[model samples]
Target: MAMDRELVTCTKGDGFWTRRILCTIRRLVRLSAKSSTVGNMAVLILSISCIDGNLLNAFYHAAPSSEIIRQSSMNSTISSVIFKDYDVTVMLFHSAYLVDIEQTEKGRVMKLDSLKNGDIWKTMDVLVFNSWLWWYRRGPKQPWDYLQYRSKIVKDMDRMFAYKMALRTWTRWVNSQVNATSTKIFFQGISPSHYNGSEWNEPGVTNCLREEQPVDGSTYPGGKPMAATVLRSALAPVRNKVQLLDITLLSQLRKDAHPSRYNGFKSMDCTHWCVPGLPDIWNQLLFASLFS
Candidate 1:
């Protein structure tokens, strides 16, 4: 039941004014599953990592005629390329958080700063970001050491407060660094998890281990998470600078879409959705937003 292959496709037009259509198809092909043909096309099987690095590589490699002005290591947090033939400058930045946060490593805390400070925002024509999954980790699993506020360290703070502070910092950065007319900014809403089976109305079940179908409804029985509320409130001030892709409610119904036992029976994984599964739906929503 292990995930076998993933496919992602992104295309940029030759016209200067044309909007880029980046379609990421993260398909997890299981070997045992029956093959189905659509029209005259045969489904191609390719293997790659998640959306960030692999997607960029696929986009560049697909265009052999385009001259790559600059190319760097695959491991770098930021990557840029100038396509001479397409007249497009594409840059990708891996900003783990919108604001500065403390990271704990080997009993040492490290401070990470905002995306604007890195000078990457200035070059981006389109920026899409998601920063909810990491915030839920607690204790050793959480990388952050302590929350830093206004040049002072706080031993502990409400998660909502920390999230809002980071989001506001990001908005302030956007206000100073981004031009709303020229740059497109998007914030993906919080992705919901199905760890608690009671959330889906199956009280005895501990997690999404044996779930094979989504909760049948337009809304989740558990409603929304508190973090989603915090996110909406934080984005209020910067609604002009950024667009929120609210995918939470739709994604919440997809309890069967997670990796679950497909990853292995070792532990229940109800967090990350299966590639070519729920994430594809998210990308479609993202694509529609960009074009709209």
Candidate 2:
């Protein structure tokens, strides 16, 4: 398989593409003829537990003191050989790096400048992360009713500004908490969505449904989205510490690769990709970077 031996799986959240990566890891190992597993990891610390939505009050409440976890090497969840007979073990803890929360007089609000969870970032060999979609969510799709920044809660703010704050909160932890010498970090660049046809130069197209052709050149006609600039700016502080897999441009050129209607599954899924298609290329890119 992908490891010199076996690969195990454990998770607290759903990442359909994350699962895909685990399945193809073995193939990547086979293709590269190389095994990338490092030494025995003490505990692949991922989690699925409860936390007070309000961090500002955490200091006053002793019940939430559990955040001061026994800083161990990490946490593990494998009972047997994950792959049965293989030689490597990989624990998938696909989690969204949660920002903090504050209880405001009006309601609960999400804090963008701080992280209330994610102390589970253990000393590991490799770390891969991708974010951005959640920042765009609004209405029922958005979880928090308000956003807290700089100690003030507001109904809303500039999304790009909020996005940068959240990212800074994450990157700051990476800069301080992680053992950079022993671990390698990778950030998958902004994965584009095909919700707007005008993004690909076809104004009336509206969606990826019935789309059959790739955008003709290396550069997409619609040009780079503003989110790309915001994302890069956020990662700039750790430019050397994190390797960004800048797939935005290339992905922007392939509007036809989205799941669209996905063979009658979701009527419209322009954000997600089709398996055995675009994600395969992402896997290849991941594999290449993993080995390189």
Q: Which candidate is the best by TM-score?
A: 1
Model 2, residue pairs in steric clash? 2-26, 5-86, 5-87, 5-88, 6-86, 6-87, 6-88, 43-74, 43-75, 44-75
Query: Which digits, one per residue and each the tens of the lDDT, describe model 2 over residues 20-133?
Result: 333444444444312334323222222211111111012122211222222112442211113322222343442343476557677768888776455645444556666676
TM-score of each: 0.72, 0.69
lDDT of 1 by residue, 1-292 (tens): 1222233222222111122333211111111122122111112111111333433544454545346665544766556655555444455565455554433452333232344333655444566776777664678866566666676665567766677777777777777776666456778788888888788899878778789888997978898998889888878877987888898898899888877776655667888766545665655665577666
Q: Which sections of candidate 2 miss by over 4 Å?
A: 1-39, 42-98, 101-107, 263-266
lDDT of each: 0.58, 0.58
Lowest lDDT 10-residue stretch of candidate 2: 48-57
Best by lDDT: 1
